[model samples]
Target: MKALHIITGLGVGGAEQQLRLLLAHLPVDCDVVTLTNPGAVADGLIDDGVRVVHLGMTGNRDLAALPRLVKLIRAGGYDLVHTHLYRACVYGRIAARLAGVKAVVATEHSLGDSQMEGRRLSTGVRALYLASERLGRATVAVSPTVADRLQRWGVPGPRIEIVPNGIDVARFRFDPLLRERTRRRLGLPEGAYVVGGVGRLTAGKRFDVLIRALAELPREYWLLLVGGGAEESVLRRAAHDAGVTDRVLFTGERPGGGLPGADLPSLTAAMDVLCSPCAEEAFGLAVVEAMAAGLPVLYVSCPAVEDLPPSAARGARRVQGGADSFVRALLRVRAEGAGPRSVPDAAHHYCITRSAAQLMDVYTAAVSCTSLGVSSS
Candidate 1:
């Protein structure tokens, strides 16, 4: 089946990474095209022989991309259009209908009582979303919290399906030899306890809070943050102001580089624990990666994180969702062991492969429902 997936950007983020997996793993003949600009994740798509149309949409919902987006959808003859992120979801659904695509679906990767940014904007978007949601075939909630959020926004009835983000557990499984080699190559002391995180240095991510919490911890614990964004300067300043700048490192945006997960997984395996202190998280990709690496995670409780089993509760000493708890949890994990344990498989039924398959089902269902003139029930 031909598929067209839309997202705000192909930048280094959880949803983008998930899209990368989808493009890579889908059936060889299945056509795929992206709505956002080609990014660090594009090389993989090209390698997989998938078509990527960089709308030059930039991240701001460019109207220019809309015409191209409409033309592309019409020309590609996509059977289904699956969208991620808010702008893309709205734009994709509208464009799909305008192009007369067979089916349209959107996934809610974030959940909230209020959005992280402008309330007025969220209100306006919610209104448009309500309209398209009624017109679209299916809606996917990355977590139960997202479902509630969509329902609160009056999403075309209660048909939203919960599809938690998943990882290729086998890919992230523990590798002691790789970790030792990575540490040696990076010149890190063999016994140093490295607390790491992989995410953009954004206000919502609360990397500053992590720095604040790290200042309270003992000196042996070093923090390594992967991924970068517009606020790297602000976050670095926050760390410097907190007097913990020396303890943290930023790898900046990789655009099209590789070393671990983005830099290659060795850095992941080298981490004793991955601390995701985001005040808000939709699916907590960084946390799950840590868990997959057998590295424990310390994060404040967030709705999307509800799907994750606390490492502490599973005998890994989880924090109580605060700065102090964060420090205590960090020390607790160190004293306990380096193994954070992988997420229980049952937690995420929506593996990338399975998620794509479900979209196919949703696609077929959308066709049938549309043909029957029945709305989502």
Candidate 2:
């Protein structure tokens, strides 16, 4: 079936990269449209021969783009319109309906109990999201935790589909030579124990907590902050203030140039341990990537990892007391020494093939209902 995927600015975030990866695995003919800046992922999509349209939305309230989006959907004659991120979900669903498209699906990639779009959760914001969500046939949650959160936010249980985020397991498999090369390229000391965190450098990610945790660790322990955001300068200053600037490394916005410049597997190979201190994570993609790389993971709160089966949860440890807890976890893992661990079978469950298959099921269900003149919701 012909499908059009819509997303808020195509920057190099998890959701944007996930869309890029999903397109390669999905069986249907799909095109992409970005509401604003078509950034890095747009370039990657173009390289992959996917048609990407930029609406040039002035801002969040740019209502004029609605008609333009509707025209595009109608002209494309798409059987399904799949939306991602918040703004796209709201506007895409509306435009799909306006264009008379019967099947519309949205993926909820980053919503949690404490925050939505890295901002404080307010009643009005929740109301706006729920209202937009109702316009779609189904909402795909990246994790079961996200599905539970959607229900708590008033989305009907049946409308929420749990589809865990996937990673390239083989790409992240541990390789001693590659790890050494990656560390050398990144200017990391051979003997130092590395603690790495990946994702946008936003306040919600609590990189500050990670910096503080690093400060408390031994001098041989180093911090590698991957991914970039507006919080870069603030985090740099915090690192300097903590007197760990020498030990802390910032790889800027783009660390590795492979795969739209994310190069997650290479960067993950360089890390001795992975940390995700964000409490409001909808699904911990980086954490899973680390596990796939055979590195131990220390997380403050991540339901995605927590929900894994015991056999698959092998190198992951959850710590509670914030920075102090992080410090202890780091030291404990260091004491245990780095050794080869098998990539969990559960990790394989999140491969892109599985994600694509689950997504196709959602798409087929939505289209089947639409064809039958029955409400999917």
Question: Tens digits of per-residue lDDT for model 1 on 38-102?
Answer: 67776666665666667766655567777788898898877777888777877788888889874
Clashing pairs in 2: none
Candidate whose lDDT is highest: 2
Candidate 1: minimum summed lDDT over ten consecutive residues — where?
A: 254-263
Best-fitting candidate, measured by TM-score?
2
RMSD in Å for model 1: 3.2
Per-candidate local distance difference test: 0.67, 0.87
TM-score of 2: 0.97
TM-score result, candidate 1 = 0.87
Please estimate how well model 1 matches the true structure, expressed as its whole-model Cα lDDT.
0.67
